[model samples]
Target: MKMTDIEKQVGDFRLRIPQLQLEDGCIHGLIGGNGCGKTTLAKLMMGILTPDSGRIDREGLTGREITMTSQRPYLMHTSVYENVVYPLKLRGEKPEESDIRPWLTRCGLWKKKDQYAGSLSGGERQKLSMIRAMILKPKFIIVDETLSNLDPDSVKLFEQWIREIQEQSAVTWVLISHQLSHIYRMSDQIHFLSQGELVVSGPARELLKNCGEERLRAFLDRESLDRT
Candidate 1:
């Protein structure tokens, strides 16, 4: 995927960049301080918000799908099975339990398949979001703070399932998060935003360990960050 010199204005903030280069089938991390345009950039890529200038050219994604799961997931007030299988049904396809079982099992939600979706915990709800998004097998996925509400145990489970799905489907992912540890653990490349500006982008682990920028270093060093 690629962006050619895009610019966006949201109130007083601006996100300007000359280019964004993403490798196919890799985990890309998006990190920044609060209101630094991480989610905004994600929205732009999703076309939920239009850029003020330039273009977002999704190279090689002409016939493929692009999907996103936000920090706060959208789950209907229905059974977990319904929530996970809704997308397939929406596209005039049958929602088969057999087809959906592996995804539910992968996210540790198979036992809760018949339960009410709204009754699940925050972490479980997030898992449902992941399951719903991943079942479609989109070519590209934007994960915006999907791990924010999870506990340590849930985080590990979520990461495992995510890795499994990614490996199985070979999808390119853009993960936006305030959690630097997750960014470090899962990302192949990293993009940083500061005051709505894209400050830097490069290899993930190297960016975390070697970036000399004060704010980025502080952000990387912080034990935890508030969900944005």
Candidate 2:
């Protein structure tokens, strides 16, 4: 699937984008500074925003089963267990007892299953939200900075699970993060966005090696400093 020359207005600023293709079974990264419209572009791709003008072609995806997880995770007014199983219920898929607990454990939320989702910490809530999204078994997953609130250990676990998902399922992932290392670690292909337009894109390593754009270069510089 790909977005072809799309543009949208966020008040006075025009969020314009160039052609960007997302490959199936591969992880794609979208990175940019604040106000670059990375999230805006993602929203447009997810059909949350109506583009002023352009076309989105779902070349490999059916487009109906796209799942998105944002930085701040919200759950229904229910227990963690209920939130995790909500998607299955919506799909009319009766989740067996076996299905719920294992996912909870995999996400490291099993022990907190009985707690109200609202009571969970930010990291835990984000983790639960991600697990819930994955349970629905969507074809395309758009994660908008889901790891930002997580600790390093939790982020590691999340990334591990992401790799496992890519290996085992037909699901392709779009990870939107400012953590360049996380992006480098997870994404097979990447598209960099700046001021609502694509700045550069290629293999992750290549982009890191030859990031000539000022914005991307500074972003990478900060990322490297943070890593140390």
Candidate 3:
């Protein structure tokens, strides 16, 4: 559920950051500019890449219990129903229509149940990816820019679904995004990543109000300007 002095190298980028202890029962958001290593951090925590130094301390997870959704989205070459059922299948649990229907409907993917996952639109694919990731109801979720690629309407739909999930489940959500409005709307806490380092992190509301760092201020200002 945390990272301790984690370091990693990916291609030309080198990431070095201290441990991140995720708050239990809350939605945490990672916001940063492009190339700031948000996705890298998510990948490191998910064990997709080994840390070069230090460690990830996931007390409850033993590899099999973790799930992640990446920025690009990953979908199997199968029907939407099959893709939604894949996570449960991997756990050796039989896939059930009852278990899968609500999530699909919530994600706005229910009507496409029998369609090929590979044929979905970008937003639909992202929703399907989330459904697959959340089906297992893992203790923690690593969502790397999951909503970044969606259209405004799709993003709105996903946001409502997220709130519903939080209300109904005990799973902790960790999200990465460059969209300041999304972060402001969803997170209970925020982590500001800069060039692979965690520059600032604290309560989302307070940080948005009094975040002293220049970079954070600028990012917030840009969001305000864009909104106008």
Q: State each model's CA lDDT, in order.
A: 0.83, 0.83, 0.81
Q: Which ranking of candidates, highest TM-score first?
A: 2, 3, 1
Give the range of the ten consecutive residues with the poorest summed lDDT in model 2. 219-228
Q: Candidate 2 local accuracy as lDDT?
A: 0.83
The best-first sequence of candidates by lDDT reads 1, 2, 3
Error (Å) of candidate 1 at residue 82 is 0.9
Best by TM-score: 2
User: TM-scores for all candidates?
Assistant: 0.89, 0.93, 0.91
Worst 10 residues of 3 by lDDT: 219-228
In order, what is each prediction's RMSD in angstroms? Answer: 3.2, 1.8, 2.1
Which wins on TM-score, candidate 1 or candidate 2?
A: 2
What's the distance in Å from true for residue 183, model 2?
Answer: 0.7
Return the TM-score for candidate 2, rounded to 2 decimals.
Answer: 0.93
